[model samples]
Target chain A: MEKAGWDGFEIGAMLRTFDGAIQNIATTLPEDRAYSQSSSFTASVADWRIEKPLFNKDYCIDCQFCWVFCPDMSIISRDKKMIGIDFDHCKGCGICVEVCPTNPKSLLMFPEQKDEESALVEWPKKVKKEKEDEVGEE
Target chain B: MSEIKKIKNLKEFSTSADRFEGANLLCPGCAHSIIVREVLNATNDDLILAASTGCLEVCTAVYPYTSWDASWIHIGFENGSTAVAGAEAMYKALKTKGRLKQPDRVPKFVAFGGDGATYDIGFQWISGCFERGHNMMYVCLDNEVYANTGGQRSSSTPIGASATTTPAGSVSYGEKKNKKDMVAIMAAHGAPYVAQVAPNKWKDMVAKIQKGFAAEGPVFINAMSACTTEWKFAPEDTIAISDLATDSLVFPLYEIINGTELNITYRPKNIIPVRDYLGAQGRFKHLFKKEYSYLIDEWQTRVDAKWEQLQRREEARV
Candidate 1:
């Protein structure tokens, strides 16, 4: 019923609105056979987390260990150096903390309610891990 | 085979835009999302992904909201192989009819199937796909359990690992049967390329994926996927557990080329005890008890035997 798309079929309709309430009213429904880009960026999983990892740039090795291991793309980085964590999307899994590597952990989990500035002031003392034989090379 | 571009730097290798936009609903430490992102990032061409209904599909695709940024399709749990073949067929037909938007463009096809989908329900469909020899890759994200429906035991679940359906108790010893040899079965299909990968080793995984894509015919890759929720390990310990699995030879990383050449890609410098791998997770906790201590020994013996067999096979190729 449509002209032969000699190149390809383009479903120009893309959904950007992610605000959906669980009400009696039927909200946005996924269209049948219609292509749409993911709108999950609009959904926040921050509330699902109980604690968030706090980053200390001074201790980071820029090895990208945390970045590679992060299941969620919450580790924000540029030019290999981790700038900060994407708090809005981070689920406080503390994976960054576990993978912080040989140096004094660059990242540590803190209560979500605690402010970073205050948390930094009383930051836990250096718990240096005994550097084992080189575990991983870049 | 396609020329593999050497990855000189990790920073530059993944400079491509993130394929996953925002967070969907995968658990904090689930390896499915990380593996998907890494696979998407490493490749250089457009890929049409067919996702089986599992953790990756359910979590990423929450109806109107999805985290996927690539051309993705959900084809249910029963027949990912058939869906992928159909998609590739469509792509070829469109190309021949001069309907392709880009004349020079060729989209590689990849189908992601959960362990349950591949091993339990969709085995025959996959076998048929392998026989048909479609120009596509079938990847089994083997997390060893039916993770989507609250962690039921699948064929891939290791002995002594408890799942919702296979409870470890005085009357029972977790899963009575051993984990199925999925890679061997896939290789038996005579696929030109077959591999077992653990995404924790990103470099190895990337290389294997590139090779799989480059292969001319059907290929199968069984990638180890660690489930933080069902596996009962801390979210942070996901990579650690996966690494341990490799070192303990519970999940060896290797590739079978032309279904005959045996290449063990990564070998442990120092083999870690099987206990370290078992103890790291809650599902295998019962295996440590006095009554079930023998199970650990059996696991170790089995692992050692398998490792030896792999080494022998690698030697035989010469």
Candidate 2:
């Protein structure tokens, strides 16, 4: 889930109908989660996996309450999109999940026991590019 | 006058005469002059002023016409705390090194800035200075708006008041946010002395200023300054507006010592409706509507809550 890159064009279209990025993110999630939006978006279960999805939009208010108060910068914004879990770096501390202001959690930690399933995915391509750029600058 | 009072002791040092005669850069009837005058009268100590860039800065220190009688430094907007904190540190360093002459008579340090600097831009630095235990007085001359910069809204501007930035138009009614509780913010940092004063009542204001300066540690005084030019009220209405504020309890006169003891000074005999205060300023004309009565109610609720909390604290202290 952390490695998946969002379709920017589709997200932009969804934003016209929704007031906030969280609502748009809810729409793209697999229907099996049984999410619904009634005044505010809500999910059926308190599943931790659904919370860690990337929000690739300009919805952050930049209150910095999140960053300043966040025990972990796990809910990070890269190029203005809310991305989650640099898996190697993430300690699964669950602090990011706790501080998020969204009614339904915005960033969640996948259970540590599910290591085999989580390791099956590749690291985000953007993360690789970022490392390469840093190397070039050095 | 009745039998003239004589100077007996330190208490007899009080005077009715204004010390800020030709030096005041504030406009006629401007509330800053009242505060400046009171501060001047309270002490003869050689002063070092750290002034933030605002109305007081632009008006008083404009080119050659400096209204400040003491040695003054005009730091950039929003860094009054850092500048004053540095000055305090330097003074302490010089004294410790035995480089400062007549150390006992060395100037008292003060940082003066408008609400914009104190409540918003310089809040972090102000908190930092307070926590570090700087021995100085920080005065926030709160006229509610960034008046010198063309009537823009500031963090201290009351809700439902209109300004250039928070203008009343079709889409919006007025400033959507409540005025920032700056005193509470300072108190949260564990400042030793914190007070709010209105200059219209000279005696009360003068007393608070003297006490604030005499405090052993960092002190913050939020003076309710009236800005005629920006509020679009008549210059002569400055005192009247200030009086209205107190009468309405919109801007109460109070003090907090070490974030514990709460003291209410001069509670008005007659508490008027908030409308009377609002009616005095053009910025609140938009709030005359029936729908906006809720805003007035909200203001009253907040005032009542604060007053009750203060009373409770005062009782607890006793």
Candidate 3:
């Protein structure tokens, strides 16, 4: 099941385990009230994106510089190989691009405005379609 | 020692081994991330972190999501030192009561706070903690203001710098008072270890963190962290600004041991003018304006005087 308000990182599942463990303490103790709330606070940093990284798998060295120096931890690494970036969380610091030792630079960043505009236009259409489907079912 | 040898070469420092968890939500160019990574890498032992309410705490430990691999506790803005002290006490108590059966188990305690919490709000608490001699490390990631509170002026704010509360206008020229000398205050409290460092020179900062962990009593490291958002600088200029601050002696890397010994860690070959540092950031841009240009000279004089004072103190210690 999708965790509401989270950016869909696999760590969200891990956090749920902690939420489960603290469920009793969270409910019983007033001091644990803060911990009781869902750990699903959206970092909401996607709006700050001015540039987004375009990763090229062909020239990648898998050194994980993008994963390492990223202030937002936007890059995802799996099995010792950096696979991709979580665009929703990436604040477009471009430290990854700066630190990448590759001569041609495997990771590149371009203006985020195009993606943002398309995404914004696509959202309401999807919502309207979903609404029409629900009305037809009724 | 192995860790020390590994970090000696910045290229060999692996991101995989870093204790700070990934996907942290700090501002893109925030220097605190580097500080956290370096400080955590200082000690090889299991760790416990106590963070006060600030940018690091709010952004890194956002309820369910945490950017730390170690056990972390948040006890509000002014309680970083006291909370860590309590945790240190609990660790000792557990060991004494045989609850922690491991014969060689020693977990290092680290407490973190911003300048707002450390310099002004938690001053008494931190002073008390230092006096009590807790076996913990306190790090003030001083960006020189209450940055987490939307760039408000704090006691740590430098003179002639604009902040939300100290905005430049017809009546006032940014912040009027000089930046508070929190390191001297900490040193006076007889802290076993007190050092001012910047992560721009990661090796120097890592060395201080190592020394801080090895110290017997309360140790404090004041790290100059550049905030790209609040300081009104380009994201890529974080490192550059930090280097400028160090190069200009605005944030000198120095240590005070046993409250008497003073050692300047890394001195620039030639001191750069304060304007190089100030003019690089937007906060101090107004100081260079024709009307307020005198403030630049005044600010430089203050920095030079402070640097001279440090030199005298270092010489006197010998």
Q: Largest lDDT belongs to which candidate?
A: 1
Q: Where does model 3 sit among the CAPRI classes? A: incorrect
Q: What do the candidate models score in CA lDDT, each in turn? A: 0.79, 0.62, 0.75
Q: After aligning candidate 3 to the native by TM-score, how far in Å is the CA of B314 from where it should be?
A: 2.2
Q: List the residue pairs that clash in candidate 1.
A: none
- The count of backbone overlaps in candidate 3 is 1
lDDT, candidate 2, B13-107, per-residue tens: 32222222232234534667556655655665666777888887776654323444345677689788778789889988998899987666646
Give me the candidate number with maximum TM-score: 1
- Per-residue lDDT, model 2, residue B213, is 73
Ranking by TM-score: 1, 3, 2
Off by over 4 Å in 1: A1-38, A124-138, B1-6
Q: DockQ scores for all the models shown? A: 0.26, 0.01, 0.10
- The list of candidate 2 runs beyond 4 A from truth reads A1-138, B1-25
lDDT of 3: 0.75
Per-residue lDDT over B1-318 for candidate 1, one digit per residue giving the tens place of the 0 to 100 score: 334545566666534446675568888888987788777776656667788888888887775566765567776787877898899988889988989877565667888989999999999988998998999999899999999999999999988999999999998878989998989888888899999999888889988988888888899999999898888988877888888889889998999988789999999899998988888888998998999999999999999999999999988962
